[model samples]
Each structure stands twice: as C-alpha cells, then as structure tokens.
Target: MFKVRVLNEEVIKQVIDMKQVVGAIEEVYRLKSNEKTEVFDMVFHEFERGVADMDIKSGHLKGEDIFGLKVVSWFKDNEDKKLPMLIGTTMVFDSKTGMPIGMLNAEYITGMRTGAAGAIGAKYLARENSADLLMVGAGHQATFQIAATLISMQNIKNVRIYDPIDSNNAKKLAESMKELLKDKFLSKYENTDLYDEISKKFNVNFEGVDDLEKAVKISDVIITATPSRKPLIKKEWVKKGTHFSCVGSDMNGKQEIDENILACARVYVDDMNQALDVGEIEIGIKNKTISKEDIICEIGDVIVGKEKGRLSEDDITVYDTTGIALQDLMTSKIVLDAAKEKNLGVVVDL
Candidate 1:
C-alpha cells in the first residue's frame, strides 16, 4: 500500500481549484436526477448519556473513482482550544479490488466541498448578469467560496466583504484573492475603474453596512459563512432574486439566516438527510417555519440537469450546505490522480 499525508490547507486549495472534482459531482447528480440520493448508513456510539458522543457514516456511490468510506467524529466543547468542534479522517478504496487507496484529512475536505457546493449553486441559481458578490464571513471557507464562484461564473467584477469581528480580515481576504488572480494570470485582478463601474451598475455601497442586515440587502449574491447560534441575516433584508449561500451552520443550533427566509425562498441542500439532521434547514424544521416537503432540490440535482434551476428571474434562492462525504471522496480522487500525473506525493510503502 502507498501512504500519503495530505495537509488540511493544501488539500483545501487543490480541491477548490480541481475541475475534475466538480465534474465528478455533476455526474453523480445527473445519475440521481431530481431524486434524493440515498443517505449513508450511520452507526452511532454514545460516550456519555446526553452530552458526549460520536458517529460513523458509511456509503457507496457509482461514478468515477467509486466506492469509498468516510468516518467523521464529533465531540462538543472543544471550542476553548480553537480546534474544530468535530474532526476526523476519510479513507478511499480502489473500487476494483477494494484495496485502501488513500486517506485524507476531513476538516479541509469539508470546507472545500461546502464552498464548492455554494459556487455550483451560484452558477445555476444566481442571475446570469451577476457581477457583484457580498460575503458575510472572512474565514477559510469564504476564501474558497469566492475562488470557486469566480472560476465557475466569470462575470463577477466587484466583491464586498463584511465580517463583524474582523473587518480587516475581510480586506486581507480580498487582497489575497487579488494576489491569487495576479499570480495566475500576471495582472491585477481588480482595477479601480472596474470597481467603480461595477459599483455604479450594481448600486452597491459597502460603507454603511455595519450590521448584517444592511450588508445582505444590496448584493446580488450573498454568502453567509459565520458560525452563529442565532440568525444573523434577517428575512426582511433579503430581496427578491437574491441568491443566498449558507455555508456555515453545519451543526445543530447554528444558524445564519432566519427560518422565515426558507419559507419564502426556493431552498436547495447538499444532502437532505445531512441537512435535516444538522444544517441550516434543521432550524427551519425545528421551528415549524418550513415543512419537510419544502426543499426544492439538491445542488447536485441542478448541476446534473435533473432538476430545473432558477425557474424565475425574480425568485429568491438559498443553498443550505451541510457538506458531504462523496465530495471528499471525489476531490481526493482528483488530487491523487494529479499527484500521480505530476509525481507529487512521497510514495512510501505501507
């Protein structure tokens, strides 16, 4: 067996840019068109009575680089140390012989897959004339979300970022994004004249939106990446034709948008079972604001042409991203393939 250690951040970057990963997802979505893909069978272990526990989810899919197992572990109250609330690893097997082919650090995979899902959602659901983007969080996922969206939808010209605690972090993120585009194409990504033109065309003003409500109101597409127990973006602030990508709130009790927002919008999810269990949709279900039948489609469904996307020009759309194991497996497959082509990884025998 060959062993490789893929770091979290590096895997995140590779997975974000790899078009093969997105292609794999699109193929899977096409096969499971309009239908909710079968959820992975889960095994739960209780450590303590109510507060402590862990769960392992296992599943299989038929597509490129098929057949895999992802095991995620959850432990609460780890926030004091700045570590992830839940952490684990995933193992991918060779579909032909069932040999263990590779292992990946799950944290990075989760962030990248979630961000990619948002980008895919924006690609299909956002308006074709979309030019300005408003991001609500300045974290790692936010960076990748912008990267994926920029790659998939090449029309974006202005990006407005807002983070309550660290506005400078948002600016730093914008600068880094600019730097990436510069390094890749050898030119400045954002020009002052272009920014001015986009700002005028979109009527966007990032100056006065000190709070979440105002920031969300003006953008064509808004991405909420904050980890909040309470709703951060108000429903009233969301206008018609606005596309919202909820990348945060993958855990229960964490929510970014109001439950009422789901009631008024066409809601899509990465995985229905996972989202209902712990994603933003869980809060809407718990509050009875939206029913189980309210979900429109999965992002994968839209990608594969199984379901309709953006039915109306003025429809309000939201993508509830909970992250999925298949995404990790597919992205890892792409990375491994690339590594083989470029002789990137150390081929240590196991």
Candidate 2:
C-alpha cells in the first residue's frame, strides 16, 4: 500500500503562513545559486486566446531530494460563476525512492510565493531609505504584493495604488490592505513579537490615486502586477533611484513598463532564459532597446554573493520574474512539513 498526504486549502492555510513562505523562497534562490536546484521547461497553453489559459511547471531540488510539478490555470469568467479565477495544485515525490510524498492545493501558495519574490527583490535591490511605494494594477495579486512588501521592508511609510482600468479597484484594494493588517496580522498571529512588530506598521498611509505619473514620480519603489498587452508606466516618469518589481507580464506580448526603462536600468531576473522568453524583459529584448548582455545577473546569483544587486543608491534596479517551478517545490515543502507536524491533512492510502 502506498500512502500520501493530501492537503486542502483550509488545512494548508492553518499550517503555513506568508513569513514561512517568504523564507522558503529566499532559500530556494540560494539553492539555485549553489547549483542545487533545477527547473524544467514550462508548458503553457491557452483555451480561447486571452479568456482562459493553463501552465505546467516542473522542477527538483537536488539538495532536498524532492521533485514536484505545479499546475496552475486562469479562467477569466470564473468570478462570474462564483469560483476562484486562479486554481493551482502541486504534487511532490521522493527522488530517492521514487514514491509519491504529498499533494497540496497550491492556489494560496502561488500568491504567497509570488509575493515573496517581489519582496525579496525589494529587499536586495531597493534603496535603504525607500519610504514611498507605488502599486499598479490593484487585482488579486496586488494584495499579496503589498502585504509581502510591507512585511519585509519596514522603511515603507506610504503606499499609493493606481489602476487605469477602474479607479474603484484601486480604492477597494487599499481598503482590503487595511483589513488585512488589522484582521490577518494584528489579531491572528500567535507570536507576540510579530504582533507587536506588525502593530507599529498598522498606521501606514494607504491612498488610491488617479494620477499614475504623479504616483510613479514620487515613489521610491514600484510593483506592477497587471497582464496588460502594452506598457502602462512610462520611462520619463521614473526617477534614478526607483526600484521596480515587475510582477506582471508573465507571457509573451504582455508588458507593464516601457522598454526604455530597461535600457538605462540595471536588470535582474529569476531565470535568464525564461525572463528573455516571457518575463517583463522580453519587451525590451524584442524592441532592441536592451541586449542579452545588458542583464546584470539572476537574483539567485546576488543572493549567494556571486553578483551585486545595487552598486549605488542612484542605480535603477528591475527584477523581472517568470515564476520558476523550483519556487513551487520549495514553498510546498514548507506547507507539507508543517502539515505533517500538526497532522492537519488527511492521509490517503492507494
């Protein structure tokens, strides 16, 4: 008989938190730099051009002796049917014995890990005194991006949100962030020290702005989480010391920032090949504004001290991520271990 731990969203939520996921993501990058991880090619497909799509990402961590695959799908019309727009599942295996280990609902994991990615970028690349942040595209992913940044970077004092498509979306997201701080962190955390630390950041100013140019100009850090077909941010509006965590543009032809920004900035990516193919840097490469040699280094290299992140305070740094499969494996490992210790999930024999 073969047994496997099956974890659902509720059980996973009870066992794991964003802080744990953030640590796991940081560890994975260090592993990558050490040549202890491998992310296989990704397979992406569309159902109706832009309406729906799915992607399969598979990878293994040699040091951990585990391999896994994450299957994530996006249905634009699912919200109307009262279902989640994004659904994800992750399955893991023991590399040594070639046996199934566990399976988990990875929708929440996806959001948390992606959030950690952006936060880590800011931690390593952004200026030490970055106090103002601009968030573009106030959608589901935007909440995680904001939460992770606020948790990781204590210097941020103001958060400005802007959405060109709908001003109400920006307003609602600002309200949701306030609720998240009060309900999720202030009242929920069992750790007293964490609660005290989070309480101090509770008074952060959250504003919804209609002027994208003004918001981008005054901000010290900017994170874009939209899937726009063209650029939403212009080059002239950005300052010299601004750090951009481009979370959108995961597919070809989708871009959030102008290619001109890449020409003058120090570019960093999660994976070089994937970034060139589908990440935010793809637009720059296609436009001939930046060449392959212009990329500084992968974030992993910087994490392991093989490369530098920000040479000077005035240097513009951009982190373009394509969502590697190793991230799913590492983050899932955290949830699976926590679930096992707490006995939160059911064990199924097959």
Which digits, one per residue and each the tens of the lDDT, describe model 2 over residues 237-294? 9998999999987888889999999999999999888999999999789879999999
Instruction: For each candidate in the order shown, give its overall lDDT on alpha carbons.
Output: 0.69, 0.87
In terms of TM-score, the best-performing candidate is: 2
Model 2 error, position 109 (Å): 0.6
Candidate 2 accuracy as TM-score: 0.95
lDDT of 1 by residue, 1-350 (tens): 55644434554344234234445555555544544333477677867755567766655555553557666666676767677767877777666577666766776666556667777778788988877788888876776676566655656767788776687877776656665443422222245344443223333223223466666776788888887778878888987789988888777788988899899999998778788989989989988999889898777777776677788878999988877666777766776666666665455555
Poorest stretch of ten by lDDT in candidate 2: 183-192
TM-score of each: 0.80, 0.95
**Over 4 Å off in model 2, which ranges?**
76-80, 185-188
* Each prediction's RMSD to truth: 5.3, 1.6
